[model samples]
Target: MLDELLARIEGRDFTIGIIGMGYVGLPLALTAVDRGFRVLGFDVDPDRVAQLNAGVSAIKHIPSASIAAAVSAGSFSATCDMNRLGEPDAILIAVPTPLDRHQDPDLSYVVKSTEAIARRLRAGQLVVLESTTWPGTTTEVMKPILEAGGLRAGKDFFLAFSPEREDPGNPKYSNAIIPKVVGADDPASRALACRLYDNLVAGTVPVSSSATAEAVKLTENIFRSVNIALVNELKLIYDAMGINVWEVIDAAKSKPFGYMAFYPGPGLGGHCIPIDPFYLSWKAREFEVPTRFIELAGLINNAMPQHVVHRLAEAIDKQSGRGLNGARVLIIGMAYKKNVDDMRESPSLRLTELIEARGAHTDYHDPHIPVIPRTREHAALAGRQSVALTPEVLASYDAVLIATDHDDVDWGHVVAHARLVVDTRNACAGIDTDKVVRA
Candidate 1:
């Protein structure tokens, strides 16, 4: 079984099945198809599957032309059927591993995906989990489920873990070019996973155990979360001193090797930084280890939305002599970061909720997101459409809050027309006016 699977992988004559066709799985499927392998994408969302099958792209960064090309080449297709799980020579799980309401590591999605694959377990197939999860999940959680069907891992089938490194809208990187870290308990599973990704990506970094690979991904995100928290703390400190944190960072980053600039924003966002740190913290409690630094960083990052909202209220009161109550505020950007429509763990949603909680009315303007869709936490913000950034629209607002630093917006137009602008991302850096204030 191993030799046959290896030969098929070498010859590119095998099918690759990917589960959870979102930001990670779809790109992986497209990359595999580009590498001369047939690919199948599985998703629970019927609408998403139908849209992908009809050659429409669900993600904004990924073009429809690419999906259309993959479908036209007969190498890629999306489906909601889990019964076809055993048909592919290799199955990759790229599902979400979000934290629960209590901020505990939620592996429900991962567990469900594994259960579906276990029902159709077959020999000569490799199963690799690409989800960012707790360190021992591949072996501790998934192994038992996959072995429940009377097949052994690394013998009847192979198992590995390789976390996905996907940066949406980052032109410099893609799933196919990023170096993958592949690890497994057995050498055969590790080699097979490495060989597969080496053919798909730029290179592979092999590790001794799946736990190490899992820890590597968590550490990466934790590093980002900590640095962002540091800068966020610095932003507050410098604000008290009446010093511009953005200018300080711009100059401090000029030192080539010593400083890597991480800007302070409204708060953390995206799939990894906001949520992946808690996965490790939750797992750390199993061994009675206290992750104080991680928990502190999480606290600091979580407090940013409230700080921005407070600043908005203060600015509104100072300028208009009125509180957030009965104020009509316009948020400049709706999506988490810049030039992307992904709002997975965005702080903007919390800002909207907080602003409304204080009796202020909130509207948003985003180039990418036309109408706000329902989110897991911010479902009440559903169906709210993006308003235009016209002169009349800008003038009508009590305060224009710049939450995201998307390059598509006109800062000049906003400052020229709005009564007051509260800049959270330092989006309007050089605009010197009493109407514009950095939050």
Candidate 2:
């Protein structure tokens, strides 16, 4: 079965089914189509499926023209129906693995996707999970669910875990350019996954087991979370000392070999960095171990939004006699990062909520995100439209809080017009103005 799947992958004759069709899955589909593999993208959202069917991109960085080209060539298509799951030779699950209310790992999406695939299980099919999940999820959690049909994993159907390594707005290290890490408990599954990814990406890193691959992804995110937490802590300390943490980092990173810089922002954002660390920390508790550094980092990162909001409130009080009880604040950049529309786990959402909870009216402006979409965490903020960043609009607000430092905005215009500027991202660094206060 492995040999057959490997041959089909090498020949690019087999269809690839990608579940979720969001950031990770869409890029994977594009890369697969780019490599001449026909792809069927599955998503539960009917509207998203219809839009994709018409080749309209929902993401900012992924161009509609690319989707149109893929559709025109009959290389890719999106569907809400899961009945066609059996048609694909290789099925990749790239669903969301968000944290639950208690900040524990939520594997419902992964479980549901796996169950759907299990119902349509066929012999010689390769199933690879590309979701960010706790270790043993691919084996302990998903393996039993998949094998309920009595088909063995390695012999009848191959299973593996290859966590998605997608940087949403980064073109340099795209899904195609990034080396894939493929892991399976069995050699055949591992070999098949490696063979499939080898054809799609620049390189394939074959690990020993699925848990190791999961651990690799978690470790990468934890490293980031810890570094970002350190930087965030430094930002707080330096702020208290009246020292510029950004400047300190800039000079410190000049020693190329010794240091790698991680910038401090309003808080942690994106799918992996904010959430993946918790998956490891949660899983470690099962082994009767405490992930002290990771938990501390989470606490530090989580507190950043409150800190930024306090700074904004403080700026409002300092500018006028009135505090943030009824102040009107405009947030610059609603997106999590610069030049991207992805707002999953974005600090901006928390900032807006925090600001409003303190009796302040907050509106946002982002070049990428014009309308805030409905999210699990920030559903109340949905349907909110992005306000224009005109001088009149800027002047109307009591203070302008810069959450995301998008490169497209004219920082000079912002600093010139706003009464108070609380810069969370150092966005107005180039602009010389006493009005700008680093958050």
Candidate 3:
């Protein structure tokens, strides 16, 4: 079965089925089609599937022309139906593994996708999970569910875990340029996964087991979370001492050997850094261990949103001779990062609420995101449209908070017209105006 699958892949005769056609899956599907393999995209959202099938992109960074090219080639297709799940020679699950309300790992998406695959399990099919999850998820959580279909993972079919390293708006690294890590306990499964990825990515790294692959993903994100937390903590301390944290980072980065700079922000955002570290912390309890650094990082990073609001309040009081109540404030960016329209775990939502809770009328503008979509939390800020940033509009606000540093905004106009400007990202650097305050 394994040999036949490999032959199909090598001959470009096999079909690739990707579940959860979101950020990770869509790019992979396009890459696979470019590599001369048939690709089937699966999504539970009928609207998203329809958009994809019609050569339209739901993500801002991924252009519709790319989707149109893939659809025009006739090797790529998307559907909401699961019965076609049996037609693919290889399956990759890239669904989300978000945290639950209590900050625990929520494996509901992984479990459901696994269950769906188990029902249609067959010999000669290779299954690889590309979702970021806890170390034991692929083995302990998914293996049992898969075996319940009366097919052994290694013998009858192949199973492996390959962590997805998709950076949404990163121009330097795409799905094909980034190195892929494939791991499995079974030799055949690992070889098949590595071979498949070798064709799609620039390089392939083989690891010992699925657990290690899972740990690699967590370790990468935890490193980011901890370093960011350190910078954020230092920013608060340095602010009290009247030191510029951005200047400190510029000087410290001169060493070039011992330090890699991670800037302080309103808070941690995006799907990975904010949530992936908690997976390891939650898993550490089973071994009677303490992840002190992870816990501390979580505490410091989580506090940054409120701290930003407090800083904004202070700026407004000092610059304008009035309190936060009845003040009109405008937020510059709503997305978590620049050059993309993704808002999962965005700190801007919290900042908006904190500003509004203090009796300020808050409005936001993101060129990428025209309208704020409904989130599980922060429903009060949903359906809000982006406000145009004219010179007249900028001057009317009691304070302007730069939550995200998008490159498209006219910084000169903002620095010139705003009554009081609180810059979190050092975006107003080099302006050297009395009206601008770095938070």
Candidate 4:
């Protein structure tokens, strides 16, 4: 059965159905279509479906021309309907796996999407999960769900886990160029999934099992979280000794071996780095094991936002001759990282709340994000608009905090006009300024 599916995929006779047309799914769908597969994008969000159907790319990294050309060529289309699943030869799940308020792995999206796919499961159809999740999520949670349609995996159907490695705002590495990691419950299923990805991506790396594939994805993010925490902890220590961590990192990066530099910041942000490690830490608890490094990294990274607030207070008091209470504080960027609109789990929200809690008037400016959403701790400060980062506007605030270092922002203007600046992202590295404080 897997051989037959592979033959059909090789002939470009497969209809690829990509579920959840967000950052990961949209790019994958486009790449599949580019590789000559007839692709159907399914999403529960009506707005996203509408945008894709209209040939408008909502994701910043994806080119509108690429989507428009794909749609116009009749190889790609999007719908909110689940019935479209039956038309595809293979299905890919790219839904979000976020954490809940208790910091537990929220698998609601994964579970719901799995059930929807299972309802339309057909014989000889391959299923691949592209969401970043825990080790047992694919074989344990999703396998049984797919088997509910009376189709056995690796026999009547195929299932695999191929986590999406999407780096938003990166023009160098794309969906097609990044190496894909593929693993399945059985060898047949693995080969089928591997062939499918190899045709679309630059290369396909096969893993031992679905659990190993899932754990591989988690390990990558956990490595980043731990290293980032190490640097953040060192930032605090080096600050007390009047040492610049950025300069130290610059000098240390000169060594070729055994040192990959990870910078300290206000806090961790984005969907994967800040939250995905905790998913592994949560799953490790089941086997009477503890992920001490992940937990410690999360603790240190989570606390950095509040630490930035405290640093801002000191900077404002020393430079502006005022307390945090009632002082005007401006956040330069709200997006999680530089030059991207994605703000999921961005620490800037927490930084904003910490400032507001201290009775400071906080505002933000992001070309990508026009308005800030109302988070649990920042409901009262909702509906804030992005102020223009001009010289005049920069001078109006008591202090400006560089939360995100977007490319469009005028760092020179900010360095020249602002009375005091708390540089969390090292965005003001080249600019000469006396009132700059690195957080």
Q: Can you rank all candidates by lDDT, best first?
A: 1, 2, 3, 4
lDDT of 3 by residue, 203-316 (tens): 899999999999999999999999999999999999999999999999999996989989999998898999999999999999999999899999999999999988888888
Considering TM-score, which of the candidate structures 2 and 4 is the better prediction for this target? 2
Task: Evaluate all candidate structures by whole-model CA lDDT and list the values in order.
Answer: 0.93, 0.92, 0.92, 0.89
TM-score of 2: 0.98
- For model 4, residues 1-439, the per-residue Cα lDDT tens digits are 6667888989998899999999889988988998999999999989989999899998776888999999999999999999778889989999988888898999999999889888889898888999999999999999999897789998898899999998988888887999999988799899999999999999999999999999999999999999999999999999999999999999999999989999999899887999899888889889989888789898998899989999999999887677799899999888899889888778888888789889998889999989876765457656888888778888999999999989888888888889899999888998776789988
Model 1: per-residue lDDT, tens digit, 289-378? 999999999999999999999999999999879989999999978888899998888888899999999999999999988988998898
TM-score to true structure, per model: 0.99, 0.98, 0.99, 0.97
Cα miss at 350, model 3 (Å)? Answer: 0.8
Displacement of residue 203 (Cα, Å) in model 3 is: 1.2
Model 4 spans > 4 angstroms off:
373-382
Q: Is candidate 3 or candidate 4 better by TM-score?
A: 3
Candidate 2, overall lDDT? Answer: 0.92
Task: Output the worst ten-in-a-row residue range by lDDT, candidate 2.
Answer: 1-10
What TM-score does structure 3 among the candidates reach? 0.99
* Tens digits of per-residue lDDT for model 2, 337-387: 999998888899999999999998999999899999899889999999999
